[model samples]
Target: MRRKLTLKDIARELGVSISTVSKSLKNSEEIGRDTKEKVQAFAKLYNYKPNNIAVSLKNKHTKNIGVIIPDIVHYFFTTVFRGIEKYANSLGYNVIICVSDESFDKEVINTELLANGSIDGFIMALSGETQLKNDYRHLTEVTEQGIPLVLFDRVTDEIKCDKVLLNDTEIAFEAVSKMIKAGRKKIALLTTENFFNVSINRELGYRKALEEHGLAVNENLILRLPFNEQIDGIYPFVSNNEIDAVLAVNEIFAIHAMGILQSKGMKVPEDISFIGFTNGLLSKYASPPLTSVAQHGDRMGELAAKMLIERIEMNFVEGKEEDFRTEIIKGTLIERESTVN
Candidate 1:
């Protein structure tokens, strides 16, 4: 069986960049005539075919929008998708969703696949791998090509575009402050690595709360867990620390810690209270409902969709190209069984 040829393949075969191959094939004047002819000859000999979807999208308005997210399994992301779908549908735009599985390569491929004129604009959340690598060349390319883009939840400051975000730091500070006021002297923070902007903000808030309360910061109590590692991996950290309370950046961490604490003969809200970000199903359905900071995923999605559409419509204007806005959505702390209420 033979495999289909792609720009990447041609670029590799010719010792050129994917961008050069694409431009050469398009008969772009930016590419030298000799190089363009060479690329075309190679493509012709190999029976290379441009993506039909991309070809169709080049000259016509498909009224479709592309949405790229890290993963669909998370409750918060699912809720956000619902919001995007509802608002985009109401505006007579169809949505195409692509999951990157938190991979940098997958994220790049999804954007390249969808950006080929298939969708009018893009709304996305940065994948964990994208954040970790700090490589946003794919995103930068999309914006440079004059595509309307909107980032939500997990976003970067490098790209100038419409963004929807939760005031994670402020809300986290409030949540941690509440715990401190409830007599929790030693609070441990369970979070992902600082690669994630949300986690960094939440950790900063946690530190700020402790400092303002005159509590000593214990570096040993701060556990930076890998994103998707099992709950059992947290046992060592929990066992070694004499934490009076725990604050996790996400519901999964908080719930897992709670289970471990109970198994070790600790009572929820009695021996050690807990709080987490993202008021998702796990937080609500745990053995004892969790107190958490709700990020309002639905609202963020709605705003992201609205912002993208507005940019698409305003794209025709000349001077408006420089205009960009970052909208911060306020988070609310929901009191529940995990905390002293």
Candidate 2:
């Protein structure tokens, strides 16, 4: 069986730029007749069908950007959206948003819905189910047809596009190291499943901090939980593990763990210390307040919007392909009452 070809595949095989292939496929007069014939012939042989939505959106400047997020209620995602809206609106671009609800089908449907000439480009974070499935054909299709895309937070390497991200591993390392410095041992890590890129990086940082500090990484102390579900297993995990400090990948997990441990008669900062990622309201309002790693989601969103808009407004240089880039935002540790001073 022959694999379906994308514009990128056809361009690579024909030794031409993607722009040239795209124009050739459309039979634009700018491409030489011979080159056009060759590109079309190759595309025909491979049964390449251009995405109709992308074709309609091409060269039509809608001056609107589509933003898709995994969860609408998530503090980090909301902050990111605020930044994107502020920057994009300043530049005369309207922002349209859709929530994927962490479902792969919902994400794909949202992409399709937004791509139907409703917007000029897209800014998105991969949904948990999309990342778990590892299927990016929908995203690849949009890019293959000359649409600009910028991924933020939960991004993947499979898609070659502009991206904005936090330094998850480094920040997690800093958070764990701070706990160790405060004379805390038997540190436990609360994280999501390994499929999520950010979780995997955070776990790496957690392990690195422990190993570098002459402490062994204990698998039994690492608790894995579902990303978008009701909190469970926290009590049992806390009961089973003799941990002096805890580092959760997100604020919800950290706050929930703190509540459970406190109810079990463990005192915050005295009996146990806690740190989590995303310095959101929940962290700030928790009974003892929580120390957290601030991801700076607003700044990330602004950068992502800038990258996507720049790509959307860039003039095509005939036969040249644009180089994609990944921008990393540095995270800061917000010290609060949950940790020992």
lDDT of 1 by residue, 1-341 (tens): 88888888999999889899889988998999889998999999998987655654564556789999999998889889989999999998889999999999999999999888788899999999999999999998999988989999899998888899999889989998999999999999999878999989989999999999999889999999886665566889998889989999889889988999899999999999999888998888987999988888899889999999888877756446777999999999999999995
Clashes of 2: 0
Best by lDDT: 2
Candidate 2 lDDT, tens digit per residue, 1-341? 86666788888888999999999988999999999999999888878997655654675667889999999898999999999999999998989999999999999999999887788899999999999999999999888878889999999999999999999999999999999999988999998888999999999999999989999988999999876564787778998889999999999899999999999899998999999999999999998999999999889989999998888878344334458999999999999999987
For model 1 the local lDDT of residue 217 reads 89
Pairs of colliding residues, candidate 2: none
Q: Name model 1 segments beyond 4 Å from true.
A: 1-59, 228-230, 317-319
Error of 2 at 182 (Å): 0.9
Q: How high a TM-score does candidate 1 get?
A: 0.82
